[model samples]
Structure formats: C-alpha cells, structure tokens
Target: MISRPYDEIKLLIENYLKKEFSTKSDLIWSKPPSVELGDISFPLFNIAKELKIKPEELSEKIIAEISFPDIVEKVNLQGGFLNLTFNRSIFVTQVLQTILEQTKYGQNSSLSSERIIVEHTSSNPTGPLHIGNFRGSVLGDVLGRLFSFLGAAVNVRYYVNDLGRQIAPLVIGYFLLKEAKYKIEEKGDLWLGKVYASMYTFLEIQQLKQKLSMLGWKIKDSSVSLYRLDDTDLKTVPEFLNSLPKENEEKDNTHKWFMKLTRIQSSLIERIPEVYEKLNKLTSSKIENLESTTNQYVKNYQEGKDKLIVEKFREVTKIALDGHVETLNLFAIFHDDFDWESDVAWSGEVQTMLAELEDKKYLRHDEKARLLKNDIIAEELGYKTKYSISYEIPDTIIINSEGITLYPCRDIVYHLHKLEKFNASQCYNVIAKMQQLPQLSVRLALYGLNRTDTADRIHHFDYEYVSLIGRKMAGREFDYVTPDELFVLAQEEIKTIIEERNYSEEEQQNIANKIAASSIKYHILKMDPQKSVAFDVKKAVDPNENSGSFLQYSYARALSILSRSSKHDINVQKILESTEKENLIIEKQAEWELVKLMEELPSILIKAAKSLRPDSVANFSYSLASSFHKFYDACPVLKAETPELIKSRVRIVFSISKCLESLFEVMGIEALEKM
Candidate 1:
C-alpha cells in the first residue's frame, strides 16, 4: 500500500542492483511491450557484459536473489530483461488514493530555485499574427506553465522589433494614410498588413521594372506593357507568358517570374485599390518615392537621427501590437513583458558588444561590413566540439559598412540585457527552425564573449513551420489567414456541431469558445515540435476524432458518472482505507490499464517539462481519454454488484477527471464541465 508505487519500485530495484553488484550502475527502466508481460522492466544486457556473464544468466541470478516486497506481485525473466508485475488490487487502490489526496499531483519543486525566460510569438509588429506565430506563442505559453508548475519562476516575454526593416514601410504607409480619406475599418494589424503589402509590392514592381529595363526590356504605364529593347519595334509581350507555370515549376524563367510580380501588385490593388493608387501615384510623381523614403526612415530611426520619425515608428508599432494582443487574447495567449529592440539599441548595448568584440580581436572588417570572425573564434574556443554542433560556423556580419548593427548582433545584446534584468537562469527562444544558423551564431557569439555559463542555459526551442493544407501563405504578401480569422473559422465549425443542443445562446458561445481554443491548441501541440504540421480544421473540430473536444467530452462523461453515484457510496477515502481487498476489485484488463495510465501523469509532466515538449502531454491526454472510453464501455460503475466495488470505480473516475483538469491547466486548454 505504497502511495507512489512507481517511485518505490524504482528505488527498490536500484538498491538491489547496488547492493548485489557492490557498485552503482546507471539503470534505465521501461514498460514491458504488453500488459500481460509486466508492469515495469529493466534490461540487464549492459550489466551482464561488465560482469562477464550472459545477459539471461545475469537476469535470472538477480531475480532469484532479489528480496521481493509485498507490493511486487510477481517477478519474471525474459531474455536479458527482468519484469515485475504489481498486485492489481493494491495498485489500483494506492494510485487512486494518491491522486485524490494530493492537490497538485504532477507539480514538484524540482526547479524551484531556477528562474526561466521564454520569449516567443515576437512576430514583427507590422501585421496581424499568422498561424505560424500562433504556434510559437502556444508553445511558449505551455512551456511557461510547465516551468511554473515545476516551481520555477517563469517570465513569458515578447521581443518586439519596433525598429526592424519591416517597420519602415509600415510607418510610411501609416503616415500616408493618416491624412488621406481612406478609412481603417478592420483591426489595426489587418489594416497595417494591407499598408505593408501594398507598399512592398509597389516598391518591388518599380524595382523590377528598373532591372528589366537594364536587361533590354521596356515597360509603359500601370497596365505593365513589356517590350524587348532588342526588338526593332515596341510590342506587347505575348499572352502565353501569363499562362506560364509559377516559379516552383520553372525556376529558370527569370522573365516570367518578373511578370508574376505585376499579378501580386494587381492583387494588392484589388484589395485596397484606392489607397494603393494614391500611394503609387504620389510616389510615381516623385512627390514621395516609397523606396527612398522608407530607406531614409530606416536609416534615420536606427541612428536616432530623427526624433519625429522614431516617435512615429514607435507609435505605429504600438498600434500593430495592440491589434496583435487583441487577436492573441481570443486564444488566451498573453505576453508578460514586451522587450523592444529599439530600447536595446538606444541603451548602447549593441555598440558596447561590438567594442568588446573588437577589444578581444574577434572583429574583422570586410569591404561591405564589420564581421565577427566566428571561424577563428570557433577554433580557439573549440566551440563545435564542445557543443557537438554539426553545422559549419560561418563568419557573421555584425555591422554593415554603413554602421548599422545587424539583427543577430542586436539579439545578443538583448539576451544579455534580459538575463541580467530578470535574474533568470535559463532562457528559451521559441523561434522557427529556418533561423537555425542565426540562433547558433548567437550562441557562438556568447561563447566568444566568454559567457559560457550564460550560453549553456540559452536554448533555441526551434519548431518546424505550419501551413494549412491546400493553401500557401506568405506573410509579406498578405495572402494568408490571420490567427483572428483562424479562430473565427474554428468557432464557426464548433457552432455548427453544437447549435442543436438546446443550450442558451450564451452557454453555446461559451462552449464554442472553449472547444475552439482547445481544438486549435491541441491540434498544434499534439505534433512533435520538429515536425511540420499541415493543419486541417475539420479534423481539429471533430469530436469523434482524437482531439481536444474528445478529451473534454471524456472528462465531462467521467464527471457525470461521479455526480450520478450516491455521495455515500463514492467516498474514495473510505473505500481505499476501510474497504476489504476482496471488495475493492479491479480484475478486468481495461480497469487495470486505465489505472496504469492514470498513475503515469506525474512522470509524463516531468518528462514533457524537461524536454520542452507539450506534444507528449497532448499524446498522453488523448491516450488517457481513449483508455477511459474503453474502461467506460467494458466496466460497470453505478450498477456494480457491491457498494465497495462501485465506490472503487467511482474513485477511479474522480481521479481521472482531476488528472485531466490539471493537464488542461498546464496546456492552457479550457476545462469545461459540460460538453
């Protein structure tokens, strides 16, 4: 009747091995492949080789000599492995009582003394957050929750890039539209997205025309008439060019790719033609050239050469962030702190870093930029071998010849500032895998600066990209669904499923919001972080499928079972403490399987938290739900033959609901009592 049977069993085995071998061994424990084999197992292959004995001989000798405790029902030998089966009646009772007794069953003080910083979803404040950004946000939020649950003080921060290159066009467009008659009807981020796309496409179109002209081509008017300069007469390009395949199919067709830019320009105009036309017309007449103006804006803002422009940049960035916050709120994701890149720049940290690198002789000046001699630094520091990294560490540009500090350089300064400010021991940057080299460069730069301890704690929690199946999304093109739109679609799908349930409109809305958020969160977090996800909305919302909705519904059903049982007959403490072993029956395979899965919640939490993977927890939740469903179908609860058996089953259901509720809390899924 040990409360934590798993820990007790592990300790028992380790002690036996240490005493028997007269030495400590690194023992690894695992579950047997089938329930009939055993509850837990340990392999003896390595230990056998060390002792110069056959693996099977070692396993048999160890099992024969080991003292079997009351909790150990049976011990068996299979090949080089030793497996132990727990007494089912005792196991079920102890697991249930332990869960019911502990308030925070899966939480511990393992990381109580550590402070962690998680910065994610720091999408440029130039537009609405896309689904890809949302994935990072969800991952970061879950990590924060997990760390806090493990007793670490977690700071969930967002790194806002107010002074980025993307912000220049946004600032220009915002200022242009500020005095115009055009109205901003949608959210600020969405409107700003349009502003960015229109300006970017406009600049690209003009730049393309200029390049084409240099290559013996001429374009006239906004309709984009193309004529080759080598031809004797001016002529419109053949219509077949428009029917040509996209860049993916024909990468060599440079001219055709140039023609595709005009179509994007057309799409931009079609969405917001009036404002686009006004900006294009003004820039065309040289009243204000978009490219030159934006470049000047970026240069001035970066150098603090123009106070007015800096203020405007901050103002526009704030507007875009406000819109982002609004959208994130709908998904229950919020950032605890917003660290601005401009603030880091203005604090002179970037310059200080560069000066230090120069002092250390790690800085190199090329014709175009100031480079960090990472190749040289890596060799001197033995960086690649020390870190076990496989990629080539290339020399990185820290500052351009024009004296603008690059992002990776600024990023290093930012990391140092945050760690010092927050007194954090660990930092997890939830960035995409595409930026792997840049992230590694940041780490290598930290090592070059002799911040090895700090660098060791910095983790790039990289995840693969997420795209909706059958749709291609380019954030710069503004041809993608925003998080806000995705939420709307999810809610609509949930609504269509539950509209006929006869609930009040408000309740229906509440249920829809919870289920929809859970669906999206579960769908994203269920997949491994390194695996690319092709999201499907229908699959996400389907209750019959293994989804968040299914987990919630299973929890609700379990709660319903507990509610229907007579209060007198559902007392977990009395059943576990006072009931006879014969009466507390758990003979069915399904019942024992459910107990085994429920007992694993604490280990699962620890594993997921340590690995920085919410997907493991998501998979566990689904399995728990599936196991509960199987048990529900096979085992009788309220109508059992005896009150003691009914009470035992009731405790199992109660414990599962508690386990799931805690999981939902960690995953940030809303736990609805009613499905």
Candidate 2:
C-alpha cells in the first residue's frame, strides 16, 4: 500500500521535472527525520544547481507548479528540501484494510519470473557443524526465505563435500577404531569428530618421528608416555645438542632437528587427553599402513573401482549428514537439493567440464599437474584489477599432481550443473569470508568458459566468523560448541524464565524450544553479514533486550490485547469500515508514530531484498517492536474513554500484529501468540 503512493509520488516528480527543466534527473526520495515534518522528503539542491537557480527558489517554484494527489495531504518547502505529508487518517485506514485483505501484504512481484539458487551450509561430512558454520546456515536460510517472499523462484541447495581429504581420515579412523572395539553411544557425527581429532594427533606424531630419524636420532623407548610431554625436557635436548659445538654445519643441523622435535612435542602436549591414548596405541607400522590405506581409499573412490571403500564412505557420510539434518531441523532449515561432491566426480560432470575447458583452449598441463590457464582469461575479464586487489589474483589449479580434482574445480562443475539443471539465472553461494579467493577463482573459471551470464549472476554472499568468548570454533579441534549443545543450553535458560507461568509442562517445553531457537537465530542474524558475531546466549533470550524473544513477546502482548477485546463482542470489521470521521480520530502522537512505522514496511522489505541483507529486516523488526511498546505505554486500548477510542486503538494494535507477522515470516522467525 505504501509502495503505491511512493511510486505515484516518484512518477509525479520525474514527469514534473522533465516538463519544467526540459531535462531528466534521477529523483530519489527519503523519509523526513521526524514524523512531524512529513512522510517523504526530496532534496532540491542537485536540480537547483543544474538549473543555475537558488535551491530555495527552485523548491518554491516546484511546489507551486505541481499538485499532490489526494493521498498526499500537504506539500511543504523547508529551505532547499521539499517535504510531502500523507493524509495520516486515510493512509492508515487504507493500509490496515489492505493488510487485512491480503494474505501477503508486504510481498512484491518484481522478480516473480526469475529463478535463483541459494547454496549454503555445505560443511564437510566429517563432523558436526560448529557455531561458525551455523552463522552461514542462518544467513542463507533467511535469504532463501526473503527472496521467495519477493516472488523469486528460489531453490536452496547444500553442496556436500563428501570426497575431500577430511573424509579420507574419517573413513580410516572409523575402521581403525572399530577394530579396537571402540563403542560410541553419542551422536555418530560427534563420535567421528573425536576419531578425526585423534587421527590428526597420531599423524602428527608419526611425522615428528620421521623428522627426528632424518637427523640420525632414534627413540630407544617406545613405551615413553606420549601424554606427559609437558613434563618432558624437550628444550634441554636442543640446548645440550647445540652446546656440543662440533663443525658449524653439523651443529646447525642438530639444532634445527631438536628445535623441530621440541615444537612437535609442544603441539602434542596441547592436544586433549583422549588424543594421547589414541596416539599411544598407534605404532609406526600401523601409522604407515593407515596413511597408505587412506590414499588407496581416496584413489579407488575417485576411480569408482572399489565397491567396499565406496560403501564405507557412504555409510559414514550418511551418519554425519543425519546429524547435520537433525541440527538443521531444529532451526527450521530445509534445502531443495543436496548436491554431493562425489556425484560430480561419479556422474562424469567434472570430466565433461574439463573436456569442455580443453576444447576452449583454457586447460594446460604443467609438469606437476593439469592447470586451468586463467592468466589469459583473467586479463580478458579484467580480473586482476576489477574483481579484487591487484596483487592478490592467483592462477587457479584444476587438478593436483596425483590427478585428483580440487574443490574449486569440482565447485565449477557443480555450479554449472546447477545453472543448467535448474535453469536459474542467479546463484548465491553463502560461504564464509575465508573462501573469498576460491569463490573468485570459480567465477573466473565460469567467465573463462564464455559463460558470462552465469559468471555475472554468481554472488558470493560471504559472511565473517562467529566466535564464543573471543575464540573462534573449529569442528576438527574438538573444543568447539555444537548447535545442539547451544540449543540445550538455551532451553535450560528459557525454562528458568517461564517456570512460574500457568502453562502446562508440554506447553512450557514448546515455548522454551521456540524461544531458544529464535534467540539463536536472531543473535546470529541481527548483525551485518560482513561483521563477526560474539554470541552470548544469555543476552539473546532476554525479553527486555532487542532480541528475538522480545519481538515474539511483543507480538504475544498484542495478541493478548486483541483476545481481551474479543470478549466485549466488538465488531472489528464494522469499526475498520466506519465512516464517522470523529470515530476514526487518532489524536495521540504515539498512535500516529506507530502508524508511520507500519507504513514503512513495504519499502523496508524491498530494500532488504535488494541489498541481500536480512539484517535490515531484523533491525526493522526491532524498531517496530519498540514503537509498539511505546504506543502501548502511552495509549490505552480497552481502557479508552469512549467506545470509538477503544476500537481505534484496537485497530492500530491489529495492524502492528499483522506487520510483525510479515516481518517474522521473512526473517525465518517463529511468531508466537504466547510466550
């Protein structure tokens, strides 16, 4: 409803300027700083300067030349600015009526026919997701919802990295641990997480031994405790060896190896206690065999030759994905497709892509590996200076020395497949900021293929990391917090707040879960994508703070008001359509302010969608909730002096509730009727 009048005003101003000045200008409108001024303001300084006339005189002439429609009640010129005020009573009534009639009042149809794909949360299937990955999940999920609300044919996808180096170790660890009869009763992903960490520690110890042996140092006691490195005198070995003072060259060599050993030992001591026992159980021969087996597993899986290895990989990957799905369900995140990296390799899509590149003369084979010759393509696309800082552009490697396809190469095939399969014109990869270079390389590869349409439409919705207590979380470290853990913690906190309420046990649990999930989502999404979030669960669930629960509680409060009014047998429809001017009176400043905030919803939605930032909508939700609270405090609904006043206030409350519902829908927030 607001967009209609806003568009009408823009067209009116554009046509008026073309006729008056015999030239055209881009007419941009902004809101007045204060509600008392006007609904929209248009600055006249630019046009005034172009016409070589004083802005004050230009504003006056424009005010006299153009006539506002019935919707625009008054036009005032303040200095060099032209402000237009709407008929508040009529605009509010009409907007409320339209919101009541339309199921989706704030949605627009500008991109109704365009197809888009939003791929996100493509975490490797080696472990459960930490909070860092959850940030991207929330961002992508909200974007999918926002684009769909704006009438785009959006498909959400998750690219599973099932054929990466991480998966190799996961498979090896599962088999090795199963042979040891290690039983895990927890989530499979969590169990795999422990195994993966232990494997890394074991591998590190083996590498350290090889480094020591190269320096002619042998360990006489394999029974020495690997866990007590903190009490071991590793530094003394380097010092004693250095003090021997043999030939300068030999002395330096001994110093180097001992220092390297000390560093490795220090790293080993830093590992969690569980990794120590795993490392102690790994003999040198077993470690060597495990390394060879991991390589064989990857090779056979890639070549599609080993059925047992393939099935083992799939079984473990399915366990990890099951855990992923469970966590995603807690946040209400669903994807239209789950694209496996192995599928790109198995379906011959990757080979087909390589063949096409070779046909286009973009593929080159160096002595060590096959590479995509992007230097010519980069120059052709102006990538060196256009895409990023001039000194940061690097050539992309398509395949390594072992004839294995890299992730970026596989990503290129995956993206092209998505475009061809879905016929989508736009694709957004909601990945972390650390992968900016890889993402850029993929886009360059697309451009190199002369697929400029796909290249130009590829958007990297890059976001920064999410940290807890100034420490970033990594899944492989086994020290990070999981989304499931955070959900449990949030529920415990929310339970304490709602325990005294008269709700049943089941109702209490439901409310706690929704509030907990909402709090987590809001905390992750309330900030700009480019900024890092220091997550604090306590502040996130507080009803007094500008949190998700606060917004939900605000809606619930409005519902409570309306529920009370229903008992009075008030005819809401009759009150909304009342023709009596005095009965429609909104003399309170708070009511007018709330109406103004409600009127900005359509414009806010359009801006948020265009900017690809859900934070804008989140910020708007907070402001709307704040305004509603202010109105509730200042104006009385059921306690009004007259029946008409009560109806008027109720109408405003109902409109606020509707607008909030629309906003929550776009933000992927659950709007609760009771909290």
Candidate 3:
C-alpha cells in the first residue's frame, strides 16, 4: 500500500540530493525507526563521502535548498546520518484513510496479477509426508498464500517424481507379500522405510561372508544359519597374509563383511518395486484433472542429436543396472531382462542423456574432480553483485555417444534437461560452482538473458533451498515436529491455556492449523539462512514470551480488543498526546523505534521476496507483534474518557491490527479472529 507513495518520495530525495551535491552518486534511503522522527531515514554516508563535510553541516545546506513537498516536515543530521521527518498529522491521516477506505487494508498491487507458479514440497510420494519435507511444503504454501493476498494470479503445484527409482524398492517390497497380488495392501514406502534403515546393519555382515567363501573355504553350516568361518578360514587367506592372519582388535569392523551385505542388499532391492507401487496407490490423486501435457520427459530439437544421446544414456543405464545392483542411483530395475539398446520410453532416457554429454566441451575435458557444465540460475534475468552468489546447483546425467558407461555426469544431465524444459523465468541447472556467475567489472555479461538496471525478472524467482525445522528434519525422526502434527498439538495446548478463546470446529481447526504452521515455519527460519540449525522443541513451543505462540497470542488479543470496540468513525490524528505516551517515542527511543517499523512493511516484503527467504517476513512479524504489545501495554484505550484521545486510541488499534493481519497473512498464518 505504501509502495506508490514511498517510491515517489524516494525519487524526489535522490534527485534533490544529486543536484545538491552536484555529483551523481547512488543515494541510499531507509525507513526511519520512529514515526515521530519521520516516515523515512536517509543515511548521509554517500553525500558525506562526496562533500568532504560533516553530515550536520551538509544537512543544513541540503535541507535549506532541497524544497521538498509540504509533507516533508523537517530534516536533521545526527551522528552523520541525515534524517527526514514527515508531518505526523498528514502521515497519520493519509495512512489511516487508506487503511480504513480499502476493503483489504495494507494490501498492495505490486504483484500486478502475474501468473506465478509456486512449486513446493515436491517430496517423492513415497510415504506419509515427513517433517523434513514439510519446510518446503509450508514455505511454498505460505508464499502462494502471500502472493494470492497480494493479488497475484497464482497456481500452487506439488511436483511428484513418481517415476524415479526411489519408488522401485518400495515397489519391489510390496510384491514380496503373498497377498500382494490380490490386494496390494501394504505400501512399499512404509514397508521399505524400516527395511531401508535396517539394511545398513544387514548388509555389513552379509558382504563379509561372501569374501570368506571365495577362498575355496568351507563353513560349518550348522554353526550358523549362513556362513560360520573359523581359524581354518584364515588358512585360506591370501598367501601374503596367511602367515599372520590377525583379527581386528576393534569390536565391529568394516572389511570382508561387505560381500555378504551386498548379497542381502541385492535380495532386498529385488523387492523394492512391489513396495513402491503400493505407496503410490495410497495418495488420493490431485493429478486427475491436471491438463498438463508436460508430464512426459520432453526435449526440444527435432535435431537428431537428442535422440542419439537418449539411446546412449539408456545403454549406460543398462550396464549400471546389470551390476547385480539392479538400479544404480536413480533408475529403477527392469523386471524382465532387456537388451541395453531397448527403445521403450521411460526405460533408458538417462543413459541416452549421458551419451550426449560426452559431446559437450565442459563435460568431456574435466579432470578427476568431476567436470560439470553447471548453470547457476538467479531468480531473474539480471546478474547479482558477485558477493550475493548463491546456489541451487543441479546435476546432469548424460550418456556418451559411444554407449560407454560414464558414471559421474548423470546427476548433472538429468538436472539440465529437466530445467531446460521447465523454463522457469530463472531456473539454472548450474553444472558446478566454478563455471557459473559473473567475476568482476562485468554488469551485463551473462549469457543470453537481459541484464537491465532494474531487478531481473527470473533471478527473483530462482530456487532456494527451503529452511527446515531443526536441521531440516530428515530420516524417520522428523515425524515428531511436522506442521501437520504440531498444528494439532499447539491447538490442544492453546485451547487449555486460553480458555477465553472460542470458535466453531471449522474456525478452531483453521486457527489451530495456523498456529501449528506459523510455529514450525518461524522456528525453522529464525536462524540465518547460511547457518545450520538443530531446533530445540522447548524453544519452539514456548508460550510465555518471545515465542511464535506469544506473538500469536498478542495478535489474537489485539483483535479481541478491537472486535469489542465501538464501530464509530474515530479520527486517528486528532491530537498529539502528552505525558507518558508523548515522551515515549522522542525520549525513550523504543516507542519511536516501534513507530518506524510501520513504514518498513513494504520494503521488508520486497526484500524478502527478492531474497527468496520467507524468514524475513517471519522475523518482521515477531518484531511488529512485540512493538504492538509494547504500545498496547503503555497506552490505555477503552478506559480513556476524552473522545479525541479515545478516537486516537481506536485508530492506533486499527493500524496495529492491520499491520498484524498483513504480516501474519503473508507468512501464511491465518490471522485469528477471537482469543
């Protein structure tokens, strides 16, 4: 909502400063911390650097000659920072008028109703949705909700890698059951999940047993269910070691154990497909009405080059599968024996993919460090300043033209083909870190894409690794904190503690869902993006203070207060209060600091969306909530007798609630009604 007015002021200030300094320099303007200080703060560093004069001296000269619009009340320089103060009466009136007048207060038209495809939570449809995958799901959903609230034309999608080999073992496991043919009852993702965890221990023993058997060694079959080797087995050890066949002093060892482990691993792997197939059947298909023709792997180029690559990729994939491992990495095993050159679809695409990579300059000529022709995609078309370099590195798996097996490049090629076909505004399949990004002194040097001065279109939409709750929970342990589960837990906890809050089933369910979701999202994203987190449960669910629940409580309470207030037209800026509230902002700084936070909403959103980190929104919500609570505590509203003061109080409530609503909604926290 403040974007249009804010933009106009920014331009005026920059132009004024440019002329005043008689030197064109990048001007920096920021939101002031306190509304009393003004709606905007302009740092004096750039001007100070140019003028060679102290900021205060520079400010007097600039303010005297600047000739700002009437809304600009005063400008001052303190601590080498030039601060601009706006007319409080005008500020409060206009902002309040906008908030009251609009049906959706604090809403902005910045999104321009663009068709945004928000893809998140593309976790393999293998098992019950785990907490680790919940980060992407919730973040993506919240972002979609925020975009919808902002008036963007949005479609939310959950990509399914239904075809990948991750499903194969599950598929295999399901068939192992005698009832599998008739019922297809137990899902493989569920069945193999436990099996997969146990496989490591299972394989460790089996692999060693096979190595002992290879030495023309006979084992006492009665002593053990499998091979039971003794000291005589040591006699069969290779001649170099036979003289001194020593056992490792270590209790558990990593040696000839792998041969037997490989045998068990292979046996279990043969059962994966049956297991995977059942899990796939369990999910209710939202894909039914999907009119998407893009489900099949597609590539451009009626050019014969692609088909050739596809075939070779399949050839290598065959070799990978035949190693008794069945599937290597991603491809599922073929149930029936097939030639390496099979032309069936979904059968050999990756090997064919690799066959082409052998032709590319970067793929074939690399050293032992695994050469990749990576594309580091920014969200938009423009290149970021080098320091902002990030990664969503995609690996490609390509098959060679000769049909020779090359193991390393498959991850890279698969990534490339998928990314190219999808063509998100800025989806880069960065082959590796070394080959991507702009070095220096090059602004518009990126390949093909435009590099204009404004924010690049695609770069703003590049994929970022979603922040997770507590090291982004993975494995089976993450089940405890999923938003889905936490949502219910928090609801029960909230219901018991805040008995005054009442709502119907639908309403309570919605609130509970929001509380649970917000807690998970905020807790996970609270840490800096670059840092790893091992989230503490006590910290996340804390209800007393500074926790997400505390913020939600404050928000719900503010809503409750206003919901009960009279619905008369109250003037927001009728009076400048004296006493505790008056000196609070100017003297105490904290109050003033809180007031300035109001102006930061738009910028915070812009920056957060631009950075592809929703944590920015989460952090702002907590801070805004804290500020509202402070203001609420210091000022008495319903008890005040003066009509004007009462009106002012009512107006403050309106603004605070509006801010709270907007912040919470953006983070996908359903703004609560009563608490």
Top candidate by TM-score: 1
The regions of model 3 sitting more than 4 angstroms off are 1-9, 20-22, 30-40, 51-57, 102-118, 143-156, 163-166, 178-192, 195-355, 361-424, 427-485, 499-513, 567-595
Per-residue alpha-carbon lDDT of candidate 3 for residues 393-441, written as tens digits (9 for 90 to 100): 3433232343322332322223233323334333211111122232111
| Pairs clashing within candidate 1 | none
Please list all clashing residue pairs in model 2, or write none if there are none. Answer: none
> In model 3, what lDDT does residue 601 have?
72
Q: Provide the TM-score for each candidate, comma-separated.
A: 0.91, 0.90, 0.64
Model 2: worst 10 consecutive residues (lDDT sum): 222-231
**lDDT values, one for every candidate:** 0.78, 0.77, 0.46
lDDT of 2 by residue, 294-369 (tens): 6788888876668888898988898898888889889888888888888887887787788888898877888667
Tell me the lDDT of candidate 2: 0.77
Which of the two candidates, 1 or 2, achieves a greater TM-score against the reference? Answer: 1
